[model samples]
Target: MKPANKFRADTIRRLIVFLFLFSAAIVGFGCSQPILESNECIEARDPVKRFYSFHFGNEMLASKENIEKRKKYLSKRLNAELNDRSDTKFDYFTQTADYPKAFRAGKCDSTAGDRVKFEVLLFWRTNEKNSQRAIQVEMVKENSRWLIDRVESKE
Candidate 1:
């Protein structure tokens, strides 16, 4: 083979290898990218999670002061209704007098207009026994912010 032709062949082979590596890198980068959640889902899910974190961390008490502290996460009507409850023994949010030790908010469902629902799991630890309950949390987008509208037992 001629020297010039051999040089051209070597260059072509290197170029092919480089192009294959570049294409593989591009494909690998694309696949490794994280899947992003929709803004609406984030907006809907964050407030619920934040509220539960605050609630559980605050000794799971739903007193008037605690309710007032978390008023930002509550709807106007719900806040008013909760405030009106004279008996602090019964927690309106958890719908139980005996509160759970912790809670987790599930995925947000935004099929309803301006409303999202989350399946919240409530956990209780008592005397080496553990119990859990599922509740449906309904939130409404009010004034461009998501707020807890209502809670119902899934049972």
Candidate 2:
């Protein structure tokens, strides 16, 4: 083969490999984002998350309508999660804590649209004599972000 032809062939080969790897990386990157984003944006603005922090005197957890800013974010989780257990006995304490320890997340599934489940960790420092446990929060995605739908004390 002529020198020019050999160089062109090698260039084409390199381009093909680059394109394939680039395409695969893009696809792989795209696939993981939705899952990470759903949880991140939600956790960043989750109502229960707000509630957890508010107890720390964050004030941003207030659900009062006049405070449109905070209320707006709360609306997402409030409407979906609150309504379901609104009538049930719930603790609405507003106590400040030393800090929110690291949270642990469990299995999460979001293949189906409109509804998805997320296991998250949230902690609070209480003056109670008993040991403080990591609270397991079950969140549901309502508008592209997860919302705390249910909460349980994880043993």
Per-residue C-alpha lDDT of model 1 across residues 1-155, encoded as one tens digit per residue = 99999999999999999999999999999889574655666688878898988877775466788788889989998999888876467677787889888888876677566888888988899998999998999999899999999999888
User: For every candidate structure, what is the RMSD over all alpha carbons to the true structure, in angstroms?
Assistant: 3.3, 8.4
Q: Compare the candidates by lDDT and give the number of the best one.
A: 1
TM-score: which candidate is best? 1
For 1-155, candidate 2 gives per-residue lDDT tens digits of: 99999999999999999999999999998887444545443453455455445444544232433234333334365444543443222332211233344344444555344444445554555587433345445455567555455455545
Give candidate 2 regions above 4 Å deviation. 1-57, 60-69, 75-77, 80-107, 124-132, 143-146
Worst 10 residues of 2 by lDDT: 87-96
State every prediction's TM-score relative to the real structure: 0.75, 0.34
Q: Model 2 Cα displacement at 54 (Å)?
A: 7.8
* Candidate 1 colliding pairs: none
